[model samples]
Target: MSKRPYSAANPSPDKTAKATVDAVKDITISEKASDEKKDDESKKDEKKDDKEVSNFVMPNYLDGSFHWSYERLASAALIPLISTQVIYGAHPVLDGVLGLVLPLHLHIGFDSCITDYFPARNYPRANKYMAWGLKATSAAVIWGCFEFNTNDVGITELIQRTLTA
Candidate 1:
């Protein structure tokens, strides 16, 4: 084996061994410190995540945050609306309300499907186009319902007429 070149800066063998031990001890201490830091950081992250999840603010009714609530309320409203229509027969007010609510309920359901199937992260262009198309279709449908309720026999009458026929 080639001998290492010795210089004034180089320590003697015993001193070199002591120095190596001290370096190892320093490194181990530093590693422990770093590990503690990592644990602290991870704990902080968990706390932040918990805070974010728990601090939900109710947004405006028009916002996506309220979508599930709106959908559920609309669905619940339908049971009473339909029940009243069946028991009391056709009323213009009920027909108009049904026309509005039914189209809106359908729109919400279809919008959810589009959101699930064409998520913006995976299909940005398709998602945008589909969302706009859905908006237009829903608007047209709601408008058609309004027109029919105003100018024709309206929705409940049409349903009754169809069921009887």
Candidate 2:
């Protein structure tokens, strides 16, 4: 065997027989840690599935309207949208992306007040339309604020193609 000097980055120690045992023990610990991480990821996946299911449950509207009123819904969204920028100091672009990508977060808060706010009760229906509208609006609002419609060359080209189409 070729001799290699002790490197701290490696588990092996040099100049002592005990170093071999230490290296073996270190390997076992690392393997155990890796196994634990796999277990954690499996657990996270399970939780994610559960959350997805719960997110789609129909609301308790109970009558001609939803659980909340339009005014109340608007106020609810206003709080978070403002707070995210004013208090939490989220970048406007990042905030807008979040607003588009996960519009449901804001939608849910507002749903407590809006009669029409529902999740995917029927695919490509009311809830789906609302979600899509919110996403589009969020993107437009963010891009407008950032002057992206004027400043972004890529967006301008894409817009030209869309307009031509």
Candidate 3:
């Protein structure tokens, strides 16, 4: 029996493929280092972003006389507008239904509301029940609008079914 001498140009010292394994390990380490660097950079930016956002301060409305800056009014109005959409669902009756659905806009009783029909009277039981029912139905309509893919036709038909029900 005999053992071979070392060779470098075409190395195969142990024949166990240690060099291939070492190359793979080095590649994995380099990838891990790059990932760590990315995480560090993102962490730094997150802190800087928080500081930048904190700089945009606002005073309270408890000061004597009232005033609305563009930012203030816009913020105030935006919430109710978004809520109105979620509250009432799509406007099948009119295009730009945001404009029409507002009580002030499309006046008379043609500006129908479930609130109008199921008026909140003084009775505790009826009032609570009606409130729950309306909320559930409104939530259903909003969900249905999101789930449905068709145009206003399907929604209008749905409204008709609800009205008949």
Please list the C-alpha lDDT of all candidates, in the order they appear.
Answer: 0.89, 0.57, 0.53
Candidate 3 matches the true fold with a TM-score of 0.26
Per-residue CA lDDT of candidate 3, range 49-159, in tens?
999998965576423123234334534554666465456664543323333233222122221242356444645576567656655655565555544524444443455
Q: State the lDDT of candidate 2 residue by residue for 97-128, as single tens digits.
A: 44443444455444433324464544447765
TM-score of each candidate structure, all chains considered together: 0.71, 0.24, 0.26
Model 2, residue 56: C-alpha shift (Å): 22
Ranking under TM-score, best-scoring first?
1, 3, 2
What is candidate 2's local distance difference test score? 0.57
* Models ranked on lDDT: 1, 2, 3
Between candidates 2 and 3, name the one with more favorable lDDT: 2
Q: Which ten residues in a row have the lowest lDDT in candidate 2?
A: 149-158
Q: Candidate 2 — which residues are off by over 4 angstroms?
A: 1-116, 122-124, 148-165
